[model samples]
Target chain A: MTRILAVGRYSDVDAAALAAMGAQALPSAAALAALPAALRAEVHGVAFMGHESFGAAEMDLLPALRVIANFGVGYDNIDVGAATARKVLVTNTPEVLSDDVADLAVGMLIAQSRGFEAGIASVRSGDWQRRGPLPLARRVTGRRVGILGLGRIGREIADRLAGFRCQIHYCARTPRQTPGWTRHGDPLSLARAVDDLVVAVVGGEETRGLVSAEVIAALGPDGVLVNIARGSVVDEPALIAALEQGRLRGAALDVFWNEPAVDPRLAALPNLLPLPHVGSATVESRAAMGELQRRNLSAVLAGQAAVTPINAP
Target chain B: MTRILAVGRYSDVDAAALAAMGAQALPSAAALAALPAALRAEVHGVAFMGHESFGAAEMDLLPALRVIANFGVGYDNIDVGAATARKVLVTNTPEVLSDDVADLAVGMLIAQSRGFEAGIASVRSGDWQRRGPLPLARRVTGRRVGILGLGRIGREIADRLAGFRCQIHYCARTPRQTPGWTRHGDPLSLARAVDDLVVAVVGGEETRGLVSAEVIAALGPDGVLVNIARGSVVDEPALIAALEQGRLRGAALDVFWNEPAVDPRLAALPNLLPLPHVGSATVESRAAMGELQRRNLSAVLAGQAAVTPINAP
Candidate 1:
């Protein structure tokens, strides 16, 4: 039987299902760390959760490995260069997560702008019994939305926000004509022109520090910052400075710099709303991503190019 | 000059505007409390905030007082009986707040369903260093939505949800045929049939105890509740019980039993998301309501029926 080492922590697919397709599924993280030398030498492929970086030691074991299927859409954790040098194929579940992340960003904006969370907290705290005047709502409709890296996900966010009547603008590496969106040359320029700036770009060396303090400072206090992309894209220190100084009205983020161990400085600020990075956490979207990954794995093992391969690797 | 005891706080249309119309404005809350007997006898009308309940003492202000303009769509706060007994014309701002409230409810539904608050909290806390799995969203497009009442605001809520392609059912005093939405005979039947219940019933004695524990239990866990109507319409204790026990998946409430004091039970619960009643908090909506009240006050003082008279009180 063709053996496959699936390294991810969370997978919706059954092992028996993978076996049915003429492959063995090995997903225990502990097992991946302690594979017998003999067995490790025989493993022909590796699959893992879309969470983090795959180290060199694990890569050294799959001498005959030809394909790597990431469980989630992002592949920053995987060493694409090592895979490329070894002629390995890499695939990720893309568009499957677009709508869910878009949905999340839109929801965050609504909750923050309307003061829904704080209002809820106030009521829950018993401070609302006296029926004081209603705290105001920040107008969301007709506000300008500036998107960084208007790729597939960015475009989807734009499409969803279109329903709310916001004008859309985007900053990208190059200009492209999207029906309702106007294009700005890059991040700082885009931030200057809009009421809200959303970061939906990818994570990698090229994008590591793209959204620095300069960009955030340019966005200013009246501007709302939303990051649904990666923490690496933003300079955490700059974001904290902007938030502490009240240079930004509010921030809604789905990812953070040094996450899980989140910057403690950010944890203390009330202006920023944090989430435990669940952009594609919806039941429908996760299932769809898993199914898509499975299809890619099956196709690649069957000697076909993956349905959605990371072009660089 | 026409003497008018303007009981409500004025917007941009200040004393100057009223002065131009041959009316002198009283600016004190205490002045409102101690109306001069002679001035009270001379006043031809009164204008008030939506929050004020004109009690018997205030109602006995003037025999010449022909009209009262309420600065909100809801006249529930106004003691219409007292006004009616004195043959005073009472006009309320309506229709203006309908779309705004409906929009807010939908926004709340989307926020809670998508875990926007959680996402924001994660971002704010700096725990979002890496993108984690997102909670998959329940299919909002086709879920069953049960409305508590078939009044104007409820009807407007139905109108917006229609575009999402969901099945609509509502509980009302009597059944009425609208182009869309199926009317249920009562709350229990509607709760039993639908997946999401939206509260939009009127306030006060008749509908105060409407949504009981039994009705909420019938909705079941995974069933969501959204209340944009008066807080009394929902049995707060019952609803909180449902939320705590996981009998209901989530709830989005704007109104509370007490105005400024949020219920401690609700604030403590994570499943229930409360909003300080921002229904009709939009600038556009508020401005429109004010304009309508101004027009009504003008027309009534000119010896014409106000645009919207609630039982001539």
Candidate 2:
């Protein structure tokens, strides 16, 4: 009888680690659903990964489930409220991946501002020598940077940008005790103050469409938008429209509303730099995340509280 | 009479600035050479730009030439030693472009390590959703970064990497007083000490091929290389071979040995992230460089000492 189920297609290293802990592994939710009811009932703890939804119906199938330990920081896919209502504990891996996510956010801002797309293309098309120098790129240093939601990841992003000598401005519900950083009352005011706006707010209903059309417009034509947070934080349709019309200068995005399925229209725009949700995808960060997730599972399975618990049980 | 001749194609802003100073502009070296003897003799101060060779032969064409004020930092193309011997003062715009070059170097290192080439391609090819997830990229923070030459731009790169919490190691002639940074005796030693090597040495015979095959090998298969210096600083054939064979993990190069005409073999390699020589290519830096060059030309024409003289007359 299996006491733990590792759900998701993990790396070989992670898979081997889970196997050593005596957990049975399934590639996806579909695979878990196909398992016999007797085997499903045996699962008391789940090591969940991936962006697939895990709702009340799925939780009902595993009646003996006591805890769900997410492999990443975000638990948007899991119904944490339902899990709490069912007396099932939930935990998420955070802090371990903050640095990596912030690093990527800073990198994307610099790359987009410096025109890596045109620069690389010029070399590939044999146009550098043929057409003289490509047009000059905009400078990245000393610009005003606005971070929406100054949480752990947002603070990390702001810290990195400080090294570039950028003026840091941010928007959140309440002002934190951060020295030398300007705090705005709302997203629009933050956008107006900065040359570039990076979204680092958490996902889910509260933050859905937080960066409205007015905020995007306030950033202006010379402004840039970078999103390392979930795509739901911004108005995706408004963003696509702004980019298409050249109302906004450029945008570098790592997440989207219906990701793994980026809109072809957004992809075709030259100013939009699309990255397929690769924040926290580095080897070091992923390994740390996996370890944290395992530790949370071990604690719960050993008849103790989860270390990084997301809900009250 | 054209007392000041604006050399090479310049941006409209720069061109207008030159015209406001009552300077006559020529499109290229060839165009200047084709001018009548009287017109060539009238030119005394040259606002020189571009990478075309401007040596004794070009100097001989303008016998009355008093100064050659280069628009960019590197004066390798101007033959400064020749200018000194001929008693024709030379000035290059330095310090102005260092920040831009350093910014690009850091950006390239992060982009290459993050698998940006594949990430951008997936979006463009509409394979993001189809190809579940891109491979895990190596982490950028907390890695050892080796700088081949710790000059002005190298120091800037090191300073930026320090913010990322990287271990900074550098190779230079006779160590300077740098605290909390490792000093390597040679290029090979520097490569051995770090996970990534960024070339920032100046160009010319003394430093050509400074990053030899031995140095590249010392960096090993897990290592990366970034070049913002002149193409001559690195051995192109050796670099291409190492990257193609996977002897070196990857390389992000902004300069090439024969730029504007990159080797097709190097262009075809997937691991190589090629960028046209754009080290100092930004509106802010270029404007500053252009202003400095014009200042050098204006001072020399008024029988005053040039501000940033590169060669003693």
lDDT of each: 0.75, 0.89
Lowest lDDT block of 10, candidate 2 chain B = B1-10
lDDT of 1 at A7: 71
After superposing candidate 2, which stretches have Cα over 4 Å from the reference?
none
- State which docking tier applies to candidate 2: medium
- For model 2, residues A1-313, the per-residue Cα lDDT tens digits are 5488999989999999989988899888767778999988998999999988887888988999999999999888899988988889999999998988888998899889889988888888888768978778888888999999999999998988888889999999998988689999989899999999999999988899988999999998999999999988999999999998989999999999888888888889889888988899999999999999999999988887788999987
Best by lDDT: 2
User: Model 2: clashing residue pairs?
Assistant: none
Tens-place lDDT digits, model 2, residues B108-180? 9999999887898887787888867888998898899998888889988888888888899999997977867
lDDT of 2 at B82: 75
What iRMS does model 2 reach?
1.0
- Best of the candidates, DockQ: 2
DockQ, prediction 2:
0.78
Backbone clash tally for model 1? 39
